[model samples]
Target: MSHTLPTDIRLHKKSRTLELIYGDINYELTAEYLRVHSPSAEVRGHGIGNGVLQTGKQLVGIKGIQPAGNYALKIIFDDGHDSGLFTWEYLLDLCQNHDQHWQDYLQQLQDAGASRNDGMIARG
Candidate 1:
C-alpha cells in the first residue's frame, strides 16, 4: 500500500516537535522521538538484529528540515545528527504507530538498564 505525502510539515521549535499533516490526519512527533528512531545507519545498523539502542535523547531538538529530492525529508537535529532520510511512507508509519513504537522503545531502554536522561543508567 502507498501512503500519501504530508500536505504540510512544520517544526515547532519551542515545543521541539515536528508536525505533519496528511489530509485530515495530523501527527506531532517529538524531537527526542525522532532522534532515537532515526533511520540512519548509526541507529538502524547495517543488518537486521544489530540495531543500536539510543539513550540520553530526552532533550533533543530539531535544528532544521530539508526536502530530499522528492521522496524524503532530511532532518537535522540539535545534537548533530543529520544522516537520516525520512521517507514519506516511513513518516506516515511512524505517525500511525507512534504509541506502540514509543512503548517498545521504553521497554527496550528498561531492559537495557538505560535512562532517557544523559549519563545515567539505572540498575535493576
Candidate 2:
C-alpha cells in the first residue's frame, strides 16, 4: 500500500507539534519520533530485510516538516538528520505501529547498553 502526506498539514504553533491529516485520520508527529525513526532509505534500507535500528533520540525534537513534492516530506530533526524523505504510507504505518515501534527502539537501546536519555548508542 502506498500513502502520501496530505497537502493540508496543520501545525500547532505553541507546542511546535504537527498534524498530518489525510481524509479522516490525523497523524500527530513529534520531533523526537520523526528524528529517531526517519523513514528514509538510510533508516529503513531498501528491502524487507534492511532496517537499521536507531537509538539515542529520546530528546531529539522535530524542527519542522517540509513538503517534498506531492509524495513525501522532508523532516528536519533537532539532531540534524535532514536528508530523509518520509512518504505518506510510511508515516501512516508509523502512526499505526507507534507503540510497538517505540518499544522496539527502546529495547534496541537497552540491548546496546545505550541510553536515549544519556547519549549512547550501538558501536556498529
Candidate 3:
C-alpha cells in the first residue's frame, strides 16, 4: 500500500512532541517515543533481532528537524542523537500503531528491568 506523504509537520518544543499531518490523519508523537523507536543503527542496530532497547529518554526533546530529500526526515534529539531517518511510511505506521507500540515498549522495559529514567531501576 502506498501512503501519502506528510502535508505538514510541526514541532512543539514546550510539549516535546511532533505533530504530523498526512492527508486526513494527524498524529502527535512524543520525543521519548521517537527517540526510543529511532530507525538509526544505534537504536535499530545493524541487523534484525539486534535492536537496542533505549532508556533514559522520557524527557528527551527534539532539537531540530531537517528534510531528507522528499521522502523522509532527519530528527535531531537534544541528547545528541541525530541519525534516524524517519520515512513517511514509518511515521504513518508509528501513528497508526502508537498504542500497541507503546505497550510493547513498556513490556520490554518491564522484562528488562529498565525504567524511563536512564540507569535507574524498575521497581516491581
Candidate 4:
C-alpha cells in the first residue's frame, strides 16, 4: 500500500496539537493522543499483546518534530519522550482512525481505573 505524505505539517503550541494536511483533507491530532499512541517499543512493547498503557499524559505537548530519513518523523514530547518514529503511513492511519482509536484508548483507561491527569487513578 502507498501512503501519501502530508503536504503540510504545523505545530500549534498553544493548542497542544499537530496539524497535518494531505491535499484537501486536514487532520489535527492532540499531543496527548500522539504521545499515547507513539510507535515506539517503550509504548508498543517488543511483541504483540505486550503494549504498555501510558497515563498522566493529558497535558503533554509537542516539543518538536524532526524528519527521519525520507519516510518517517521523530516526534519530541514536552515530557522528554522522543523515541517514536512515526511513519507517514502510520500517521495517516492515526488520522483516519482517530475517533475509534481514541475511544478504544479511553475505554482501556477506564478498565484500568486510570486517569489522564498525572499520578491520579480513579477508585470505584
Q: Enumerate residue pairs that collide in model 1.
A: none
For 1-124, candidate 4 gives per-residue lDDT tens digits of 3446998999999999999999889999999999999999999999999999999999999999999988999999999999999999999999999999999999989999998887468878
Where does the lowest 10-residue lDDT sum fall in candidate 2? 1-10
Residues 8-98, model 2: lDDT tens digits = 6776635656687777887776666766688777777898869676666666667777878767778777677888987777777777888
Where does candidate 1 stray beyond 4 Å?
Answer: 1-3
Q: How close is candidate 4 to the true structure, as a TM-score?
A: 0.95
Model 4: colliding residue pairs: none
Which residues of candidate 3, in runs, are more than 4 Å off? none
lDDT by candidate, in order shown:
0.92, 0.72, 0.91, 0.93
Best by lDDT: 4
Candidate no. 2 TM-score = 0.74
What's the lDDT for residue 88 in model 2? Answer: 74
Decoy 1 TM-score against native = 0.95
User: Which candidate, 3 or 4, would have the higher lDDT against the true structure?
Assistant: 4
State the lDDT of candidate 3 residue by residue for 46-98, as single tens digits.
99999999988998999999999888899999999999999988988898899
Candidate 1 residue-pair clash tally? 0
Clashes of each: 0, 3, 0, 0
Candidate 2 vs candidate 4, TM-score winner: 4
Query: Which 10-residue window of candidate 3 scores lowest in summed lDDT?
Result: 1-10
